[model samples]
Target: MPELLAHRADTEPDRVALVAGDEQVTFGRWHARAGAVAAGLHARGLRPGDRVALHYGTASWHDYAVACTGVLRAGLVAVPMSDRLAPAEVRHVLTHSGATAVLRSAGRPDTDLAWSATLAEIEAEAGGSVPPQPPSPRDLAQILYTSGTTGVPKGVGATHANLAHGCTLDPRRRPLAHSTHFLHAFPVGSNAGQTMLVNALNARAAALTAGTFTPGRFAKLAERYAAGTIFLVPAMAIEMLHAKVHTTHDLSAVRLVGSTAAALPPAVALQLAAAFPAATIVNYYTSTEAAPAQTSMVFDPERPGALGRPTVAADLMIAGPDGRPLPAGEVGDVWLRSPVAARSYYRDGDASAEVFRGRWVRMGDVGRLDDEGYLYLVDRDSDVVKSGAHKVSTLQIEHALHEHPLVREAAAFGVPHPVLGTAVAAAVVADGTLTAPQLRTFLLDRLAGHEVPGRVLFLDRLPRNDNGKILKRELRQLLDDDRATQ
Candidate 1:
């Protein structure tokens, strides 16, 4: 893989690289800023292989992109920390990663050993070409911190070779020719967004960053720029479908739509297929540690829950209770081995040993492969609910409830029980008056006796984290509170 900044400058120097609000920044200008950031960091007593923590958000996409890529160009590890983290959490990560300095916008002073530079100042300093550095394929490129549904997030250290393999999975690699425009609406500092940024850089595709993901605003950007590709999550997809922006904006230029981070409802996928009839709507199953592993390219209207087959570059296994690979059609823990899988966590040896079993990564997800080899995810291992003598997958129950025509969203969890040890409880977002009996009746045909939810809670909306995953821990608290009152 080419140094991200150098690759773009060499292939598409004059192409537009950034579109933020009303302003347009070309690859030439973006490259210059990146070089300047490298020079600034070097001037500040930073050295090769040193770590830099970026603690900024959406407004600094261009800045983050320049700084992060520049870090790579300068032979350093780029660590993108979440802006939502508490100051103490941020401090912990900075200390854990052993980052030499924290990069932020000009005003932030609360961080320890910080460096701030306005965009204009950074751009002015790097006027000439950045000297080429010899490429090392195994060099650490980024350390991304992702906290799943439970526990503090661990930092996954990814290498350049790992990212190169992930990029090759893009089916539209041919269409994403040099100078093609790619619009990115996700927060730049996120693993997903940064992945897209790196792909665009490697392919010399022009980069366009929206300030944030607002359905209406993003559609306007795609229409305005005639972008060819977009990456989003299901919530963003639902927002676009509901906003009716496709009708108002010219989305004909979009050739590919990739979604990850959370499950994309089949109903939502169907709507997107209709909206972008000519484009490929891909639902990729992967994580920050293991980038796009399995993806479904066929958006046929007939299939219900078809998450596609594995990409040629990824090696996936479905392991059962005995730590042996299970036969196709048997749901088990999803283990992935791929070129994109991170080497290990930074400085967290125990966590690394637990997650990284040799080259394969235990994704903490339960899934099975069909006879034809398409993978179907049932639930995460941590989300399974064992009640009395029965083992239940909460996601299976939730998906069944969501299939009910009256239900908009559904979440299922296990509630403690004295006799049965645990009872299945469900919370749903629905319209019309829905009684417990009616819900039970609706689920009777779709679920077995043990899988059915005993108690149903109705809510206007389900609580979700910043990345759009539902927060079941909060739901458990609500159930506990209600039980206490009763």
Candidate 2:
């Protein structure tokens, strides 16, 4: 990590490395500030390998970047915790990771202590020399966390080598090789956001964002900068497409539109194709635990639900109940062989054992590979619905619902049934009046009868996490509430 900053600082000192709205951080200043912070940490009696927790928001991207670099340069592990996290969530992460020091946005002045410091305090640490102890590529660099929608979030411990697997100082070999500027609105502390930070260090383009993401603002920023590559989560895609921002702004500058975090519905993909006529729409599939080991698909109308094939140098497989690899077209567990030495959950050997198998990472997703080797995700393990003797995919139902003219947003969850083990139910935010019968009719055309949602509830909006992932548990609770009322 230190080497990356030093290289950029030496070569492109004046070029902006990161942007949040109107503010920009140049490689020279960013690298220099990080060096000062590293000296400060050393003066404060923090030694190499000590865990430092950085709690910051998108608005504090500049400070966060400096802190992360400084921590790595000083040979310490950085634990990134977003400001959007709930207090309990924050406490859990801090406690579980055993972070010895905490750095947050500048709020007040405090003595530079080993336990805590502010961004202002860190910047005040005056020193010209780099910390004598710099990190090695194999040393732990950062501990990023998962979303924890189903339970407590797990901290993913990644070494510098893991994160810097493909990063290079060579201009021609940089990631996002085709773009001069890449735009995205992903939240801080997420896998997507961390990847962007990595890109800012290694990508050919200068990373750009609007800090806190709003669909309209994101679209405008891309237009304002004339970004050649744009990346976003599927939820952001849904909102932008819902507002038809393409008609409002000229997004023809984008040659590639990359969607991540979750599967992009086929309906949304079709809309994206028309919205950015010049762009090749792409769906990127990978979990926080299996990054640099996933698939990338250039949107093709011929393969409707495929999530593309494993990227260059990455291998993927489907596993049956016994954990043995399955043949093509057989639905089962999805796993990918990591491009680097596999990462593990911080201090949780049980979890590490369950998720990491040799160099392969279990995606915890139910999917299959076609004979053509394109991977199609059926559903997440928890999101799949068991309707009597048949297993159904909520994503299939959601994609079908998204195809409905009046459905603006949709989610599908399983509800307990009297006879069948579980029944499929759906919740939707409609652009206009849409009812159960109407949606059922719409689904019958696109889905199997067993796959059609048995119940449909209309709402103003679906509940979502800070990262814009729909809260299926909340939707299921709403279903239970409606049943109780009846």
Candidate 3:
């Protein structure tokens, strides 16, 4: 397994690792705390491979760090469920994961399931000073659940080696010391969130993690802490733009501003770039089962859809339906082979086999590689709108709609139809006075007739998950409701 803070503490004990709210923890203290937590878990009869659910927020980054570190050190698998999940969702994940124990926010019993606090308190009482056991690289470190865009949530098993490789971007260039603080607005338990945590630890950077995305509060916290770096999802960036909150903070201390978890539209990207003029704005792309594909450093208006080039060790390619690798400029399914990929989905052999092809994993995303090797997403395989004889990419149309001066966000989906078999429908968020006709006119010049959305539904905002990915299922429901009313 990857080296924990305890290892680092043995070498550089004085370095600060976490700076959350008014709390500060040195590497040595953090290591000891993790060991204590691990000992507590072990005493409660937890064993290797046992699932330990963590429902804490990012507000206390060190709490999660210690808890997750403890889980790994105890040889147990950490299952991080989103704090934003509903009670039903929480129970489903808890029962599905077979969690023997759970760690949640203090006194937030309402958020926990039946008998959650009692179990945690019992484990907490078992706490004592103890050294952590070393783990092998192949040991299962975490089991992350996907957003379940297609169906029910599936657990993706990640190894320590995978975690280690995914986190480190530039080992050759060391980052600023721990005194340099960062504000983390992303979920601490998500794949991207874990990756950010690893990056911070490797750089010895201090972090002030928040619970939710309150753009104004987050910006104010960044100013208060003089944050040196931050990682945001595109949706959060959009919120920052809408609230005009970034300007309220002293963001001058920020040197790096990274975004991922969802596609970054050209308009939102440019707004982020203009807002953080000094910081490098990186538009990243990756799936829950695979490592990040690219990191776009320079956001240009002309090449808005590009997800940039591969990070370090990822081998990305486009594969045709027949499994043959597609040449550059050909649109096909995106395939990835990386040391950072998950071993397989937990206890899901059939599901695992479907995506994991021994070494390489099929990302289930359609995209193309430019002549320069930059990857551009077309859409998800399921999101392909098949109407009569035409196979239209909803993402391409969504991109075109987003290009409209009035449109804020757009999602195109296929609705069932008797005559054409399926029809294309769109849901949009807009600010200006652009009508459906105006939108159709704008898209006419950019997209083909078959690809244009048949209906345009406007909403206050696009529904999204915790990772900021638009909920197409919800969009399809909205269309179904509209049809019933008619």
Candidate 4:
């Protein structure tokens, strides 16, 4: 990263590198500021390989990017933490990663650390030269913590090579070659954010982001900047469609729209395709542990739900319960092997061993590959409900519910049943009035009798984490409360 910045500064010094709100920083200025921050860290006695935690309270993408680049330039491992994390969660990361110093934008000091500084303080120092020792490709780059909806979050340690595998300093061979600007609203300290950072340095397009993100705000930014490419999660895409941003803003510049971090529902996918008629809408499938090994499907109107075939750099397969490879059309654990090496959990060998199998990593997702090699996801293995004699995919039921014209969001789970062991239940966010019977009848036309949700409850909204994944555990608690009342 440090080397990439220096090269860009020399070759394209006057080119715009970042656009965050009103600030437009050139590559030359960005490199100099990062160097200043690196010199500041070295002055504080932080040496190579030292872990530095980056926690920010504001939505300043430029500052966050500078802090992260400074950590890399100083030959230190960056540990990015989200400000949305609770105090206890922050403490756990600080204690677990053993971060020697903390760099933050705003907020009270959340952890007991020997050294801490704000972004302003870090960029204030003057540095004349780069670090004497540069980081090697094999050296640790960043420790990204996964969103722990099921349990405690684990840090995935990515080496410099892991993050920079396909990244090239050559502008001729960039990811989005035709795009002039790539726009995204992902929060810093996320895998998606890191990927965007990589694109900012390597891609021909300048990285553009907003200080705050709402569907309307994002649309305005895209229209204002003439962004040729935009990336979002499924939840964000759904929100944009609901807001009808396409109707209000001129989005003709957008030639590419990519969705990741979660599956994009067929309904939302179709809506997005219509909204961006000139763009190629894509759904990317990959995880924090298995990045750059993505499977991208250019939204085919006929195969809207398919996750697409693995790219040449990736090797994807389905593994049965016995750990043997499964044939096409059989649902099982999805495993991915990429040219880039898999990352490991930081200080958690047991958890690492469970997911890593030689060069392949278990994606923890249940899916099947079709005869034509297209991938179809079922549900998270942990989220699947086991009834008396069948395994039910909550994602499948949720997708079906999303097909309802009035339904906005839906989450399916298994509730305890005295006779059947477990019964399917669902919580929905819908517009029109609907009853359990009505919903079941709606499903009967599309699914088997057992697949219909036994209990259907409506709510204003579903609980979601910072990454926009539904909190099933919270929904399960609601089911428990209803059971108690009965």
| Full candidate order by lDDT, most accurate first | 2, 4, 3, 1
For candidate 1, the TM-score is 0.89
lDDT score of residue 198 within candidate 4: 88
Question: How well is each residue in 384-478 modelled by candidate 3, as lDDT tens digits?
Answer: 98899998888888778877877777888888888889988898888876677778888899999988888778888888877778888898888
lDDT of 2 by residue, 270-331 (tens): 98998999999999998889987879899999997899987652388899878899999899
Worst 10 residues of 2 by lDDT: 106-115
Error of 4 at 379 (Å): 1.2
Candidate closer to the true structure by TM-score (higher is better), 3 or 4: 4
Against the unseen true structure, what C-alpha lDDT does each candidate score?
0.72, 0.85, 0.75, 0.84
Q: Give the per-residue lDDT of model 1 (tens digit) for 1-486.
A: 345456556666787766566656676777766677776666666777788887666666766666676667666788886566677778777877888777765665556455545545654665553534733778887788875468777788888777666444333553366236777676644667766666656554566777667888899888887888887887788668767889999999898888878767777777788999878888877777666444554655565576776665247788887778988988899887765545688778998877787677878888888887777778778888889898898877877886776776778898888889988988877767777788888889989998888877777777876676778888878765543212
Candidate 4 stretches greater than 4 Å from native: 107-110, 126-130, 480-486
lDDT at residue 380 of model 2 (Cα atoms): 94
For all predicted structures, in order, the TM-scores are: 0.89, 0.95, 0.90, 0.96
What TM-score should be assigned to candidate 4? Answer: 0.96
In candidate 3 the C-alpha lDDT for residue 20 amounts to 71
Q: For candidate 2, list the clashing residue pairs, or say none.
A: none
lDDT of 4 by residue, 1-486 (tens): 788888999999999989888888889989888888888888777899999998863267788888899899889999988788888888888888999899887664745664788867766654454454779988999999998988989999998888888877776776776767899988777788889888888888899986556999999989998999999988889889888999999999999999999999888888899999999999999888888677999998788779998866238889998889888999999988866778999999999999987668899999999888889999999888887788898888888898988888888888888988988889888777766777777898877778788877677788888777888788878765553221
